[model samples]
Target: MTTQNDAASALLDTSSQPTNLRIAGDWTLANYKALKAQTEALVGHYDGNTSVDLSQLGALDTAGASLLVELLGAQRLGQLAETATHLPAASRALLQTVYCSLQDFCVPEKQPEQSTGVQVLARIGSAVDTLWQDTKALLGFIGLILETLVRVLLHPKRWRMTSVVAHIEQTGLNAAPIVGLLTFLVGAVVAFLGATVLASFGATIFTVDLVAFSFLREFAVLLTAILMAGRTASAFTAQIGSMKANEEIDAIRTLGLDPVEMLVLPRVLALLIALPLLTFLAMLCGIVGGGVVCAVSLDISPAMFISLLQSDIGVQHFLVGLVKAPFFAFLIAAIGCLEGFKVSGSAESVGAHTTSSVVQSIFVVIVLDAAAALFFMEMGW
Candidate 1:
């Protein structure tokens, strides 16, 4: 029901039916309180009549202003016949508009409710099933990679051999000095820590053994690969994201060129070619760094360091470390390129995907190193 009240009237001289309210005063809060009774009288006169006239009401306020609306709402709730009061044109239109809106709100409507515990569990089971299916798809992808690797192995000449060579020359040869320097520094740090403890036990000479064994087997290669993954992987993502934004990739597609083959294949091929070579370089530099520390702190001669390294480290251990590099390289390149393709139409999406690519590639590289370690151990390497 509408509540409209006015306390005073301004237009009462125009002979009007007692049922009709006429006001000439400015419509304000106090006016409606006085006119509420007159408006209610009109509604009572035609309680169930077809229509009621209210056109004579010169003005109305919020309180006595729109009782006709309430009258209509009450009638609709009781399924009673509705009435149309002769209201001023503006007032009639306003009341009718509000009446329509109230009808929509008051009508019964159906709504869906969420399920409880058991249903939630069932939904979770469905999600897990979907994840399992996606995981199977990922495995299928790995199988494809294995198949491609085998094909390339069988037909080395048909493979993108030049691309791989170029990447190796660029990524490995150009990166050699930096990778060597970093590994050397890392080895020095490791040797210092080992020496600090070993000297206390009068076993300082064993620092050489610790540095050689740890770097050759793990740290040197893994650290180099991880650094390259962060550097090269982020570069790949940003490059591809820029190309995607510029629609160059779309242009290639229009020209009947595969973006994957022309773009991704080269980077992937290059990293694979570079990783093993860089890992070998990293190990050499780390050994050199450890030797320097041995000469300075442990008083072990360079010749002795070299001779010990030659005798203690085997080709098999080097191969174990080398074998993991190409795999890590492939992982880095693939994740980076894939995330690049995930870029949307916004610069923000590109930045987010670029960061994700680097982080995911690094995580994958570490996990892969652990797995490789387990595999090599199982093989008794």
Candidate 2:
């Protein structure tokens, strides 16, 4: 009753009794498609009395043995396989092997969900860990810079004067105009505020003292440091990060030159020189802007404002602000160079570290300035 094609491939007998599935024909890869199609809806049909008959089964392979295992269901196959001594030894072995392999197949369990508070706490912990790592990296980089710098300084023949001078022109001279203009505007605003507030108390003349004291001791250095943080810090990171991305830093190392000495030292030296000089210029420009505001708004002449400035604000106040400049410069340059070395050799990494350098430099400058302010206040300087 069977066609030759049906008899050539695997076949499942549906005419058998309800508890029985009879397999026949060659159970090999050549018949896997027809076998799978036949077994799809009939698999997992297990009642306690269910049975399988392989008495008429023909040539078999792993592919067809797997199909037989699925047809009988794994549990019943366990019981029926031991007593299937009438089956071909090879067929019994193949079925046992396939059953053993698939015995553990099962669905996986879903993970439990977490509460929102736990998620937030995890994020906070991650941030704190990241912050601690950054602090350690910054400190380590600072130590390397100092050690390399001292060694280079001792051997003046190895000094990179040309590079240092070029950077000074770039980070200092080029930025002078903007630093002056912006600080001048801020100074004018501060003076106007002081004058307006003092006028109500009939002490408008003391506005000269307010401008001189603020600009000389705080605003001048603070503004210059902040400006350099955004300007110079970003520039250092981009320059060094680009070199890192291009593998130029590796080339420097390959050539037996220290990257910290050849690259970082020049920048740190340039910024150390540049920031203090810029701070001085910022002080002069700020005082001049305040003088201009006083003349226009308070009807105070330039001479009187200068006299009040000289009398009320001593040279000590100027020194107090200037002393903080080198510290801020060193930290900013160190941070930029450190972040630059951290680049993972991609354009996006360069940009990300550049941004990170600027933010860290600014944050560090503000914190150091505040600490310096407090220290100087306590010292009565």
For candidate 2, give the lDDT of residue 368.
89
**Candidate 2 whole-model C-alpha lDDT, 0 to 1:** 0.86
- Maximum-TM-score candidate: 2
Can you tell me which runs of candidate 1 are displaced by over 4 Å?
A: 1-170
**Worst lDDT 10-window in candidate 1:** 75-84
TM-score of each: 0.66, 0.77
lDDT of 1 by residue, 1-381 (tens): 222334344222223333323333434456544555545544533334333333345554444335434543433422321243454555555555555566667656676665698679999999899658744644564465556666656865657767767767766788888899999999998998999998899988788889988888898779888888778888888888988888888999999966766677778878887888889899988888888888998889998888887887787877777788888888888777777776775788889988988887788789888988998889899
Provide backbone clash counts, one per model. 25, 0
Stretches > 4 Å off in candidate 2: 1-11, 15-111
Q: What lDDT does candidate 2 reach at residue 21?
A: 55
Root-mean-square deviation of every model: 7.4, 6.3
